[model samples]
Target: MNPLYISQKLFEHYEHIEEVKHYYGLLAIYALLLTAEEKQDPVLLGKCKTVLSRFPDHIQHPRYNFPSYRIGGIPKAYSLMKDYLPEAEEQVRYYAEEMLTASRDRKGIMSYPYAPEKELIWIDVAMAVTPYLLFAGLALGDEKYIDEAAKQTFLMYEEFLDQENGLLHQSKNWAGPGKYSEDHWGRGNGWGYLPLAELVQHLPQHSRHRTKAEKYFKDLSASLLPYQSERGLWRQEIPFEYAYEETSGSGLILYGMGVGMRTGLLDREKYFPAFKKGIEALNQICINADFSTERSCPGCLCPGDGEEKGTVKAYVTLMLPHRDEHHSFAPLMFALVEAYRNGIYDLPRDSH
Candidate 1:
């Protein structure tokens, strides 16, 4: 099947579903924005404006209202929509300033500002906040916003990255203070890696931070290579051979790798085989005939309690994959769009 056609069908599938106001919903919207831009489809772009217009103001979810989580894709959406939507500039600026003043730990890392482990920080914040701020900075022409965007990711990298393996732990303080989650969860790695990919791909070439972001992106990509399953996906518990192949994380990783290859940060000769295998496998297994997706892990954040919390065992056991989960849609779209951009039109012949 054609990747672009598949992506459009998938977006249509999402449009029929109930409105999702959380990060996952925003992620799908972000994917649509990217797809429309890449394809230069004015109709799809109009759809983006219409979908975004549904959320005129950020509606706080009764739960999951952490500052970083709330910011989600608003900045990118704002950057893309500002010219079209009159209020886009104001909405993005509001969130950008909010992020600047959000709570943080003594190390200057942003933290969830609430009771019950308020000091906690995690890799997920990279996806939640980094790109948002980057877009905001670029849009507003504010160096301060741009600097904070780079700083957040760098600080998280310092705290969560496992230097020995080059894979990152999901979060800190979820297990206990000054401790890190045991498993290098697939989505967690994607969350960490994607923003750096964004930074490298979008940052001005002369920006002082681009080199460091590239290094981090390249290192994580190299480290993840050995862990890719023979089937071209990464497992839920990435290093664990027995864990199930997961598409959400795999899609995010593939998207980043595609960005790396496109920008010449990753060598096509070295990475293309894995990329080809992954996109092919994604089309073959994860996406259904109707373009509904499956096998993407559902919403998961340091699951479990007591002894099981933050353990690799819990990561593999507690976070089960489900059909048509919200998290799955965007990653699949992201991978497919990147694949299309890289001139991968169809699945491998053997896949057929």
Candidate 2:
């Protein structure tokens, strides 16, 4: 089957499960819509409507019980389906503004007041919030929100970036106060790449701001290049001393590089091998036709550090064991779409 077919079939089964955070499923909806649009498949287009209908008007965050990534997904879905669902135009447009009002601070950057411990700068903030904000801004004909998306993206990078290495730390104050952790968790890198790549794609042509995002994308790509394992995968803990080879983050990197290659932001000769290696790594997934176990990084938090509070870990034990989970599948869905578009898989290479 073609990748879109396989991904659609997989997510069709997974989306029905009642997860606390439907953001992953919500994102999957956008992926399906984009794929449908690209392939011009009316069947997939119709499914987008059905899948989006499952979300509530006021999509609540699973943990915080507030508007968040769930709500952000609305404008993205709406942008793709607005013509067909013309009646929903006003409602969806208004909800986009509502999202910014609900989560933004004085500077229009994200501020989750009720979060468990006041995590103002999670790396995933860039991923979960920026694209929706950009699409919402465009859907509503408001450039302000677009500016916020760009501003917030760079701000998040400033806060989370591991300056020395270029990849991002998960968050500024994840473990506790009076401490800062620099562990470059793999998925944390995914969070950064997903948003940066999407923002770069949507940026206005000839705007200097587009160049700003492109610089960040290029720098991050260079930073991560040295870490890609010989197997074409990045590890859960990034450094070889800490954890096992992983999939989700690797998929995310592939997606970002694919986007960069398409946009001419990444050089073909320099990044092509890295992109090819990622596909080779993904082909190693032992996906059973019957949905058995497979290799993937489990959801992770900042590894607590006893030795240095939060700055460094004596032994980062938070690297969760691999399993068949959304972390792996979500980005892989994105990677396949990117690969199909970029012809990464079609490039001649020896089969694994």
Candidate 3:
């Protein structure tokens, strides 16, 4: 029941695969970086480097696909690997600058800002793209990147956040019949949550933006906590019986919560149990079940069709029949790492 042991199984599953080249690749690369950091293993770092090597200059690499801002985290992965590889810094700066310039030109949004169209803002992009924004800002002693991050973060918050429930919709529609999904998709919430937690993690502690981000984190945590089921996992549609408990949402939410606990961003008394409960749930659902991840929406554009109205029915029906979905792999491994880092719970076994 070693967490690392379990994580290795998931990592090895993606080790040789090359078909995925978008968010999955970006997430897998970031997950590998986190794994390398946690293990402090050169061999693991080398493995991460191998992933980066696949796209040598991510800035110009046609495959990396710029202006999506999914490419933001990719540069951080490159920067992290700089110690192990010589050209890492150059690559990091290049992509970071290019992504910033592209967003600037696009009026501060990803190229694929929304589903089935453009200029619309996806809630997930806050997490998908902002890490590098905050990171590059801090790394280069440039408030511009950090400022951009805060602007985008707050904009997404302004657009998608439902302050009434402290929940969020999937995307903001620039031009559409329906602006966004009606239901609060669990994984979508996770996407929003993780970025705020990440801002708390990476930004200067006393900065006004960090303080605001922390408040946002706590408020969202308060909002999301009630939805956790008796099984300690959140469902696809969140607190809805129509859909089953999902792994990717659970993992992303769990990772953010665990990191919040570790960083003191979340209240220990209120959240530790929730965090521990999530890990236990994951152990029961995924770790012991041959690393199976159930109920994952396997990487598709949500609300992709005009017919697929953003309803609870649409959400539950489409986000189903999950089995070994690779989309779940990164977040689960991420949660595993953060669980280890937080030390709230150990491996499922009595002894790791």
Pick the lDDT winner.
1
- Candidate 2 lDDT over residue span 1-352, tens digit each: 4555555555654555445235665666666666776678988888777555545554555653235444436434345334645555555566556656655534444655576345444676676667877776766667876787788788878777777788887765556653456678777888888888887887778656788899999999888888988888887767654466777788788889889998899998998888877865665552345322255656555555565534334214555555557665667667767877777434232232
**Residue-pair clash count for candidate 3:** 0
Candidate 2 at residue 62, lDDT? 66
* Residue range with the least summed lDDT across 10 consecutive positions in model 3: 63-72
* Comparison by lDDT, 2 against 3, better one: 3
Residue-wise C-alpha lDDT for candidate 1, range 147-244, written one tens digit per residue: 99899998898788888899999888877787778989999999998889889988889999998999999999999988989889998989899999
Ranking by lDDT: 1, 3, 2
Q: What TM-score, computed on C-alpha atoms, does each candidate reach?
A: 0.94, 0.85, 0.86
Against the reference, the lDDT scores of all candidates come to 0.82, 0.66, 0.69
Q: Which candidate achieves the best TM-score against the true structure?
A: 1
For 251-345, candidate 3 gives per-residue lDDT tens digits of 88998898788888788899989888888787667543445555577653354456566667777776564666777777788888887787733
Error of 2 at 226 (Å): 1.9
How far off is residue 103 in model 3, in Å? 5.6
Superior by TM-score: candidate 1 or candidate 3:
1
In candidate 3, residue 296 scores what lDDT?
A: 70
Candidates 1 and 2, the one with greater TM-score: 1
